[model samples]
Structure formats: C-alpha cells, structure tokens
Target: MDCDVLVVGAGAVGAVAALGLRRQGYRVRVLDAGQPMEAPTGEAIDPRVFALSPASIELLESLDLWPRLAPRAQGYAGMTVWDAVSGSDIRFRAAEFGLDGLGAIVENAALVSAAQAALDDVEFGAALAAVDETTDAVTVTTDDGRPVRARTLLLADGANSPGRQALGIAVSGRGYGGRAIVCHLRSERGHDVTAWQRFLPSGPVALLPLFDGRVSLVWSADDALADRLLALDDAAFSDAVTEATAGRLGALHTPTRRFAFPLRRQTAERFTTRRCVLLGDAAHVVHPLAGQGVNLGFDDLRALLVAMPDPDVGLRAAALRRYERARRADIAQMSQGIDGLDRLFSTANPAVSTVRGFGLHLADVVTPLKRRFAEVALGVKPGFPSASG
Candidate 1:
C-alpha cells in the first residue's frame, strides 16, 4: 500500500487535508482507527457543530466541499459577547464588515462526511500498529497486518496522537481544571442570526445558532460544576444552562443529551521529525472558548499545502521545518492570547474587571481596531490562501 501521502485520521481536518492533497494531484491514502461518520439527517441539530471561519469556509470552497455543506449550515450575521459579572458586552455585526455573516456553523460529522465523499477511498477502522521512516519514504503498519508506504505521513490523529508519541515527539500541556459541556437547546427568543457568548468566572458559555431555529451550547465550566450539571436530569440541566446564560435568549429548554470533555492547553515540542509531520490537534490544542480549534487545523492544511503543493516534490525535512516554524509562532500567539483572556476573566478582582470592561468597550467604539480584530478572527487578512484563487 504505497501512495503520495498517508493521512492518519479521517476526522474533518484529516479528511480535508487528504482532499486538498488529492486536488494537487497527490495519491493520498487516509487511515483511521474509527469508523467513518455517517451523513447527518432529520430535523435535529448535531450536538457537535463547528463555527467555521471565513478562511475555513474558503478552504472548503476551494476543495469544492462547501456547496455540499452550505444548505445544512447556519450563518451568524453577528456576534455578541459579554462578561457575566462585569456587565461588559461587545457586539460585532457582519454589516459593519460588509460581509454576509461572521461565519457558518456546521455539524462536525457533516463536514467530514462531505470531505469523505470527495475522497476516492479511506481505510476505516485501521489502527496504526507501527511507523518506520526512512530518508526517502515512510512505512506504516496497521493492525490488520497491512503496510502503507508514502512520501510523507500526515499525523492528524488528534491531540493525543499515537504517531507523535511513537516517534518520541514531546508535548507540553496542563489540565485547566475545567470541562466543556456541549449540547443543543431551544431558546425562547429567536437566536436572530447572532452568536452569543457570556464569560462567567468559571468559563465562557456560547450559544451558537443553528439552521433549524435552535442553538448549540458550549459551556466551559469548572470540573466539579460540569460533573454536577451532567448528573442533573435533562430538565434540571436545561434550567441550569438558562440561568448560566442569564436567559439572554429568553429561556433555554429542550436540550439534547449533554456531552462533556476536559479542557486543556497542549503544544507539540516538535511539529516534524524525519518524513512524518503533525497537523491539527496533533500539533497543538488550545482553549475552546474562542472556537478556533478546528480553524487552526484548517490553517495547518492550508500552510502545508501551500508550502509543498505537490507530493511528487517529496516531503523534505527542510520544507516540513518551514511549515513547523511558520505555524508555531501563530499557534503560540493564539494559545497565549486565549489563555491570558481566560485568566483575566477568571479573576474576581474588581480592578481587573474594570480594566477588562474598559478594553472591550474601547475596542467596540474604535472602528479601525475593531475591523482589524474581525479580519484576524475571520482569517481573511493577508498570509492565507483565498477561495477566489
């Protein structure tokens, strides 16, 4: 089993990476230990949804996968965020940026399914048993006793990537003593095409709109609170969520089954070694408060593809190092920024609260600075590939 590139995960990021490489005429083979995601159906919103940035949307469009997902996506025209304790609120409108919306929210499974459909083949339930790298190529052994050879092996298997560990790549991260609670809820007031977030002392709570008049909930809570909330019955949990959100959308109810995952900050010490390289969560995992986890993964694909557009060029260590260096700085900046903001909000000191409030208000009133922030968040600024191209 030899190919141009071997993608070690079939999730949205890995699938999209494989699709992009294929578009560049690479004979790509994707291997995943998990089963393929089924196409979503029915009226209910998938509990796992991603707020796709403009750059992510463009990446999908460039790969010709956005059209398959567009009808199922919900576009938010504005974003409203406030501090639960300080009463400081900031709103960003799409009209202000002359864009239709801030971003599109699509189910995670749907995006992967769409990307899978575009691929020629993906080896499902194929756990990687071992990896052997050489100067010119890499050989991967699967659980089924099959061997795969490729010029480059993309280890996008996620945060706790086995490939990275097998190759002895170190990672530095710490548990944030918090867990994210995710679910879908029906709000009393319409979401109004606005993505709302309220930063509580424990963590931030986001109510992202869905296409079917519902909103997805992402509550980052302290570990104990998360356990307590999850232990409650559905009705009680919904009430807790409504209270936590201050009923901004009137009242939230009809919550789907809740899901929770521990929050942490992780960064791979090295992004590449030999003929293998890390991508997406495999390289870094940041706070979910900003909803940029998957977006960062897409950016990884964009950077890697741009650096080495063709597989035939071979996966050179120098090229991989360039991609690693380029992404490390941006990842560090985002990781630090989000961590700093989380710490700032977590503090209960009145003086810190006042300073934070003032900063949010100042950014809101300053048009140039606000637009610059928006551009950075949307990934439409310079240094990224455009859909038009």
Candidate 2:
C-alpha cells in the first residue's frame, strides 16, 4: 500500500492528524494497533477527560466536529488554583480575556470518536513491525506481514513510539515520582462551571467540572501515598478526596473506580528523522498538572498543517525541516514551563513556597499579566494556525 502520508497510531491525535492532512488534499492512510473506539454504553462519562483549549476546539470545529461534541462537552468559564502548603490562591476568568469560556472538557473517547468519524478509513488492528526510510519514501512492514510505503510517515504512536524507536530516535525523561489518580465524583455543592486545582507538596489536585454536574478529579500523589490511596475502599477514597480539596465543593462522594498512572517528563531528542516525524506524546510528554498534554498534540497538528500547507510540497525536506523548526520552540517552552512548575511545586522548602505563593498573588492582582497568562494557556498566540493554514 502507498499514500501521500502514512499515519501510524490512530489515537485522538493521530486520527486528527490524518483527517487534517486529508482535508489538505493529502492521500492519507492510518495504521493502528488499538481496537476501534466503542460508542458509550450509557450517559456515564468516561473517567478520562481532556481540557481542550480554544485552539483545539477551533481545530475540531474546522472538521465540523465541535458541534457534535458541544452537547456533551462541559465548558469552564473560569479556573481557580491555590497552593495547599502556603494557602495562596490565583483565579483566572475567560471574561478577563474577552472570551466566553477558557476551554471545554471532553472525554478521550469522545474526541477519538469525533476525529475517527471524520476519517474515511483507519486500518485497525494493524500493528507496525518495522520501518525503513529510503531516500524517497518511508516503507513500513506490519506485524501481519504487509508492506506499506508513503512519502511521509507520521509517528503519533505516543510517548513510547515504536516508530520513533525504529528510526533510532532517543528520548530524555524523568519520573515526577508521583502517580495521578483520576475518577469522577459527585459534590455537595455545584462546581459553577469552574475548574479548580490545588498544589500540594506531593502534586496538584484538579477538580474539573462535567456537563452532568459531577466533577472529574485528578489527584497527583506521591507513589507511596498513591499506593495507600488506591488501596482504600470507594467510600474511603471519596472521603480522602473531599479532605484533599478542603471541602471547597462541599463533600465529594460516589467516586467511580479510580485510575492511576505514573507521571513523567519526557521529550524526544529530535522531532524528525528523514521522512518520519513525531507528533503528540511521541515527541513530548509533560507533567499533566496543566492538562495541556493533548492540547500540545493538537498544536503539533496545527503547526504541521501550517508549515506544510501544500501536500505535494509538504513531503519535501524543506517543508519537513520547516515543521520541525516551527514546533520545537513552542514545545520546548511548554516542556520547560511544565517541568519548572512541577519542580517548583514539589519543593518542600519554606522559602520557595512563600515566594511561589507571593508570585501567584501578584499575578492574580496584575490584570494585564493575568490576561497574558490566560491567553497563553488558552493556546491563542501570535502564530496560531488558521483553518486555511
């Protein structure tokens, strides 16, 4: 099989990348080892949810998907973040940035469904076995003994991308020494469509609002503490979560089965090798305290689409090089910012805590600076890609 672009990994990012490229008039083919996403059996929200930035929403809108997802998505007009250690807090509002909402929270499955629906075909159950890049095309061998070739191969296989490894790419990563425990819970008080986060010595705890009036909880805990928390019964876990949030939303109860994953800061040494390029977690994976992991992926698609606006010309070395240079700076900046925040908040030093708290307080009071910060987080920037780009 051959195409203008071969996208390996049909996850949300990979699927979106393929669809986006196809929209740009590229003959794109997607290969994935994962099963097709199943429709939700009921109205119960999936435990995994992503905070979709305005940029991401725009990208989805360009594909005519936001309308389908809007009914199920929960939009937050504001966010409040505070430090548990120093009791300092900062608040951000969409109104401050002249936007109706900061972002929308949508389930992972929902996004996959939306992106997948936009695509005409995705080769499910197709695991990559080998990748061989030639002077003209990247040839791939599937696990089932099939050969495929393309002018450009996109490796969106995720943080541990086999496609990246096949190209001898290296990654630098360090564990945050914490695990995030995620679940959905009902609160005694309304969430008021606000996303809340509190930084503790261990990690940050976020309570993101949902459309159904429940909140999604993301508690990043130290490994030992996470173990203990995971061992607790459902009621006990709910009690702990309620206490952790300081009962801000009143009491949180009826938590769904909790999910925990180790947190890490990872980035590939390079984003491109020959005709194969990395996207999403394949290129970078940062601490999730900011909930920008997937958003960064969308930006990857955006940058690629912008740099290589013409498919025929996009497969060239110059276009690939342009894409590499375009995305690296933004990815690096975000990676550093998240890494710095993780390290800063994880520090137990009293002096650092005081300084951090003071900084938060100062930012809260400084209107222009606060708006700038909000804009940055919303993924609206000077070089953001338009639908045409």
Among all candidates shown, the one with the greatest TM-score:
2
Clashing pairs in 1: none
Model 1, which residues run further than 4 Å from truth? 312-314, 368-389
- TM-score of candidate 1 to 2 decimals: 0.95
Candidate 1 lDDT over residue span 340-377, tens digit each:
76887887788988988887788789877565555444
TM-score of every candidate:
0.95, 0.95
Per-residue lDDT of 1-389 in model 2, one digit per residue for the tens?
A: 38999999988899999988888999899999988885443567888899988778888998887887888799988899888888888888776666666789999888887777778589999998899988889999999999999999999998889998888999988998889999999999999999998888888899999989999999999999999999999889999988888899999999888899889989898998768889999999988888998999998998899877877689897888888998889888887777777777777689999998887889799976565555444454423334332
In Å, residue 27's CA in model 2 sits off its true spot by 0.5
**Which TM-score value belongs to model 2?**
0.95
- For candidate 1, give the lDDT: 0.84
